[model samples]
Target: MTTKNLPIYQIDAFSDVLFAGNPAAVVPLSTWLPDDVLQKIAMENNLSETAFFVPVTAGNADFHIRWFTPTVEVPLCGHATLASAYVIFNQLGFEGDIVRLQSKSGILTARRYLGAIVLDFPKQPIVPETIADDVIAALGGDTPVETFGVASRDTDLVAVYDDATIVRSMTPDMSLLAKLADRGVIVTAPGDKTGLDMISRYFVPAIGINEDPVTGYMHCVVAPYWADKLGQDDVVGYQASARGGVVACKVVGDRVHLTGEAVLYLKGEITVSA
Candidate 1:
């Protein structure tokens, strides 16, 4: 078999500092490759998400994008989308300020906003759910202030807390949570510190991520929820995982503007054969 050298980059999204935020692998391609190869590269990179993009010729968007986790292909991902936009604007030497991507979730736009890169994503409809016992038990016995179901997934649920400390100190049973109906349990609370309105942590061990450092996609649901609670459209969210990250958000009708900083971590080449 022949090998093709592909340029790849690993970027830490939603943080200005290195080693913070979530790291995603970005692979820009001129043509589409086999799905198996794309999945293989994601597994090889071993990150929570690897983003692949091919420039689109049609009108609605600038490029076609896809996201893959170590185990499955997620419908939408925020950090990886941010990473992809970073590549397009800074590394690829594009002069434009915005990059629109057509994704499985729909058309998502990433632009430079107030010195931070921003991603415009569809807001998920949040509906109150009957909190389950296992959901509370997964968080080590701290019952959330409330819980809701997100339109993003049939099994995705959002749990709100009263304070940030509860979110930071949570040590959920990843194994148990994985088996629970909520495939992605988003635990969030009001930010305790200055310059932050909210804080959150994401656990989706069933899809192979136990705790996502800074979840960009989850914020689509979170931003709207907080905007309603805070009675404001602009808000700041800090994901207090081991590797912390800050995402600035603005809730627009049916959309959320997700903004954050990212630092380039590694640029390397990967060899693949079809």
Candidate 2:
């Protein structure tokens, strides 16, 4: 059988500029695409992630959403959710003022607030842990004085370095990173150059992304950790990834709210063989 045609939208999430923020391919479908096909599409697109959406009605509200990377399906993705909401609200001309996503993680809601999109996500608090030799080798850094694992997946490794430059300048070994058991590693330090509370860089070679341009999920854990340390709930975050982006973060109860703007970059279609 011939493959059906699929529509795809490339959107830059968490930034207003075309090149800034994370670029995610949004594909809205009537039914869920096969996992293999989705991965193939993501690999073909070669973006950090590609989001797939399908409508679901539960109890009182109707929801739509799903997220995928080139290699695997993820439980949650902040930037892609922002990109999906952007497409639903602006491109599809969705009438509702808010969009709710029923994802593998749970129900997540996004709404327009003060010209920026705000996403309410679960707060992931991780306690500091002993740094392993392999983790340090993957990061290409001497053993950090302190380390923390964020969330249950242990995808985020918060390593505190002495200076911001040390965190920014170090070149990591992706091959070694892929061998790491965690989903991703995050190296961070107090920002000396900027007035922001802190600056960080995220690498996820294990999941097929060498470095994520801007990571909203990591901030879910970072925002809370830094908030308590700095005695402030609201703060700014800078992802030191090559194609970096900024995020405004706030911690509310058990949830962390991340707000940012997204820009539409490329629009195209995909033809998938059956």
- Candidate 1 residue-wise lDDT, 7-125, digit = tens: 89999999888988999999999897899889888988889999999999988999999999988888999999999898888899978888889989989988887767988899988
Deviation from truth (RMSD, Å), model 1: 1.3
Can you tell me which runs of candidate 2 are displaced by over 4 Å? none
User: TM-score, each model?
Assistant: 0.96, 0.94
**Cα RMSD (Å) per model?**
1.3, 1.7
**Cα lDDT tens digits for candidate 2, 138-241:** 78856666788875666567787767777778788998877874578777777666558778888888888988888888888778878888899997888887
Best by TM-score: 1
Q: Which stretches of candidate 1 lie over 4 Å from their true place?
A: none
